[model samples]
Target: MSTVAPRFRSHAEDILDALRENPDREALVHGHRRVTAGEFHDLVHRTAWAMQGQGIERGQTVTLLSGNLPEAIAVRYAAHLIGAQVNHLYTGLSADVQAAIVHDVETRALVVDPRLADRAAAIVEAVPVKSVLALGPSATADDLLALAATRTTDPFPGQAGPDDICAIRHTGGTTGHPKGICTTYRQVREQRKAGRAGAIETDAARQLVATTIAHAAGMLADGVLESGGTVVMLDDFDPADVLTTVERERITHLWLLPPLLYQLLDHPAMGHTDTSTLRQVLYGGCQSSPARIADAVRRLGPVLVQGYGQNEGGLISVLTPADHDPDDPERLRTAGRILDGVEVEIRDEDGSALPDGEHGEICVRSAMVMQGYWKQPELTASVLRNGWLRTGDIGFRDAEGYLTVVDRLKDMIVVVGGHVYTTELEDLLNSHPDVRQCAVFGVRDEDGMERVHAAVLLAPGATTDSDELRALVRAERGAMYVPARITFPDELPLTDVGKPDKKELRRRATTPTT
Candidate 1:
């Protein structure tokens, strides 16, 4: 009988094919370093071969701790091609948390950056991984790059199938332990495909990725590589450097969080920066300042795209560049229409679908939704009902097919005589002239009763009193929506993933004074 070809295609192989098409073309840039498609291709294969030599095989987990380096990207693909699941230790998380994650994933190989050698050694001391490979020569770990250099550049078919586990990205660790969101190769591939298609499939574009590559930028980077585009990596985000890079690189694509976007807009360089070459600025992680967004649209051309989704469900919807209309301000508040190949429904507590305008839990169904929370079958069952993943976000759909996510299902504040939606108040606060940034959360008193608490960051030279803020909320939303206790913090806390850190905010509100 003739040999049968596998049904599933690996995303790694997709990059390999793209790399083969133009070996000499510049593929990646980091400061002074320039890597061509040929070099990146060889790096992926060589890393894969080196891992295999260390006995890393299919179904094993490969955890990484590194900055946004080109080799980190190669390591991710190399693990994928070898059928190893990948997980990244986020920079902001505590060592204990990272150790717990490493133990939870049962990581077989720990690929670390030379800079993070101490952190990697700490993890190894606690978790005892089978292999410790450093991106470069280090005191604690063996040099993986040196070993890879000895391997041939011969390409091999990917070891994993479509349904095999490709990644186990953990949640932001808001709730006790961070739950690992396990995604299969098929789920990951389809998610990227849908994202690329919705964003307009392009052949080539220079994209600047300034966020953490272990999370949002990771998927975007894969898409950029597959399209034969150049990715300019930034170790850290400086509004000045980002603006300069855009003007220097003639960057066509740029992705950033809303806060970072606002900083870029307000930066002094923004006035002189040549941002006319920008094609689109993809932003989404949390609620954005509508005023700043409109300002960006006025300053830059009409090229603001907002992606709305969570880890449980990939990208559920996107507010396209066209949706950022200056005239229709109400549309700016919306999360936009559901993406293609994705199904979204506003369901009530009983799991029944609600009609438009009725607020309920936002549920989504698509090939992109995670397979399940890693090894948590019961938890998975509670959310994934009949192929639909229940996103804990509470929102309603308008008649025009736009989704508006209000307060989170868990974040609904139970006040003295009624309930308060945090977003309702935060949105109102964000509209005020003096408010720079704010996060509203509920904290329990000694009687185990919840009261509204707000941590706000006032704009420079702003003297808006807490009384005025409360008065504004009372007038706009209602008395109940006003913050019971308002504290003007130096800065609002944000999670590693860029979302508002309500947990930490709540802790601060409840904790006793020194």
Candidate 2:
């Protein structure tokens, strides 16, 4: 094994340093399997050596298609050690979409889970990557685990610089094809530092990672490992299973989306589960219903922390546990104060900054912000203006500096007399007892004027009158804010990342039926 002291500059290097410091500490816990920090470090090094032997080079892209497995984690770090850009494909995405992303990134190799062998095969058929390495046994590809076992567990001599592209994360792509948000090693390290500084630290935080580690949950796992804590991974999220794991593992932190959080709240196990060990329950990815958040605060204690960010802007703001006030209902509606080291401004269409309480595009400039979209220089230039990212989100900041995101700029409905925000109406509708989930969007009427339209998912075994919902919206917002049509769908179409697909909803609204 190579014994040269590891240089600690990038986030990946820092993680290696943490592993070296706590060699015997448990780094990961998945089901009955456990890997110590030392073991994980060795695995990563071996994987990196194997990848190098396979001709993977610096600045090349390696696409990972796997769930929350130890091998997946090791491969990601190995790529980082070898200066390869890691692009994680969402497991739930269609094979066609996955192939498109792979081709777009021009991935040199694909590291896939054994379970997703068929999907990987299909993707490879479409994209034709240079190498296909499976986590375990595979009929058509080399076994990454077996290859690592035969290789020397020596850290790769190569290391990525601060400005080198470390990752290419795919955005939700709610409107169209997913865009790859390019992030560098320096930005990732800065983001990690900011997250650690802003977090409420606990000794040896036992983090329950029930979501995909490919995204923000993976970042949270890094934070846990950095703090000498154990990461308990779940292949898939089952609300009851999550509750059981929390109690069994004594989980201290959890990162979930609003929908998953809601399921956890509604789970019967939630009532019996011992979640007192939880310090922070971070949620984001979509606008959360205030009612659901308030309920979470009441049931889950004051542990709910909301993160408002995008693929382009990494965690621009966070609503801390202290900010989840039940008494201050309006404050709960805010996305929380701007994150440390992040600058946020609500700007008008003319590129001028708007005053407090005036709604406009939420612009951000931060170290955590992505370098730009990969292979889309023109699109990147359009959004990135003089170091500020034009976040297409429409929101306003209160005098106290708390941000209230209304809706996406494109999702805003302009009526003849006034304007309507989709989230504003959706939030009110979600508060209804019978409504399980809802989405609001605008469709052009006969006169070419935008009219509000809604789709709702009712609670199981529950029924609701559309007129009642309309009256509630009219009373809470105004008569003009009421939806022109309300359709009760079996379930709202969800994007690959699990957010409600408003673009699809708009298509359904406009399409003619027999």
Candidate 3:
């Protein structure tokens, strides 16, 4: 045993301790492979040893490019155990986007999932990285798993301090650079100590992870493991597959974005699939349709949970299972009560508090609030005022203490699926040869869902239609960034300051051409 003592241990060590309680319990399930608690614990230790040998020191960033693989989760724990900051790249992002993030995050070691070897290769070729490793064998990088096999699975003291940063999760789909929220090891322990992760989970209380582990799913998975619960990983979310998996695994907890939940509810399999084992159907990546959510509550029983949060604000509020009242549409529209120990205040542009019924930006103060945006002091100062995280989200709290998020102050548009930054889309659109000028904004549909909209002016001798330009965006930034409505006007509206008149463009987007 190493005698090196650290200021404190991370939640990673706590999870390892929990794994021994029932060593034979099924801890991880990925396709045909089943990992018992003992096996996973061993894998984590081996991985930590491998990374340590490679000089993965505390606070060094380890960026991962993987799907929902069990090994990917193990890598996260391994990195955490070694006290390295982990930055998980979301899979669907363009190669350049991933490279930009990896470069900005100052990654010391890049871990690739064998399945994403090609993608990793592209990033590796683009960026000058220190070391590259893969979860399994691939020509793109060194095999981390194979390296781990040669190492001993010996337990060691955690090399992290309570105040040391542990995770850096990016808030934007930013292609230009990386900006992320920083969370410390102390906050991780505080989150657990505060009982925000819910009651203790049994081995029988299985959680299904169909979403990307780079975001909320990762947090949920960690909580599940800390409580000694089993986790079933899905490489991709097919509505039918999710339904069958829920029934097959006897899953007690499932998490989804509103769009994904809608897809599952609409799927033919949902009607026949046995979902009686489900204790919670947690959903909330964006503002959801109340009517659709009400429909879900009626169909799936009173198990729907909507967690309203931000990367910077942590989980501000939670719409509990008991709060999913189908009879009260008004209640369903609300984002539920502010969570315990979390203080929320509605503030206007001048930073003065707003009345309960008035809408303003929701500011939060709590243990879950991030330390700050990683290395961006100016941006951090803009949001973090006197220990409060100014969530760019615009919402109002009723006299009853229920929040109703009606709009967002940020330029990013939040859909049922994902947030598309208008600036990022505009930047992409302006890069095209056919574009003279372009402006992007969001407009709400009749269903109260935000849709991306753009106005463009073609350069001389150019004749690109909206469809062609949309295809370019869809190809470059993925479907989420594709404009729902693209209008090729003779000239784009401009403000007096010569800036693209996005406000006017937004109005024009909502008002169709005659």
List pairs with backbone clashes in candidate 2: none
Model 2 has an lDDT value of: 0.87
lDDT scores for all predictions? 0.86, 0.87, 0.80
What's each prediction's TM-score? 0.97, 0.94, 0.80
Best by TM-score: 1
Q: Write the per-residue lDDT of candidate 3 for residues 253-321, one digit (tens) a residue.
A: 988876577668767788899989988888876656666677789998988888787777767777777
What are the C-alpha RMSDs, in order, of all predicted structures? 1.6, 3.1, 10.8
| Residue 7, candidate 1: C-alpha displacement in angstroms | 4.5
- Candidate 2: segments with Cα more than 4 A from true spot: 1-8, 200-203, 444-449, 507-514
Give the range where candidate 2 is weakest over 10 consecutive residues by summed lDDT.
Answer: 194-203
| Order of quality (lDDT) | 2, 1, 3
- State, as a TM-score between 0 and 1, how close model 2 is to the true structure: 0.94
Pairwise lDDT winner, candidates 2 and 3 = 2
> Which lDDT value does model 1 have at 34?
93
lDDT by residue (tens digit), candidate 1, 1-514: 8698856678999988999899999999999999999999999999999989999999999999998999999999999998889998787787889999999998898899898888888878888888899999887788999999999999966888888899999987876799999899988888888887677333587889888898888788888889989999988777999999999988988888887887788788899999999888888877776766887899988888989988779898889999998667688888888887899899999989999999899999998999998888999999998889999999999988899988687888998888888877777887888876778889888898889988887888899999999899888888788788999988667777666789998888878899
Prediction 3 global C-alpha lDDT:
0.80
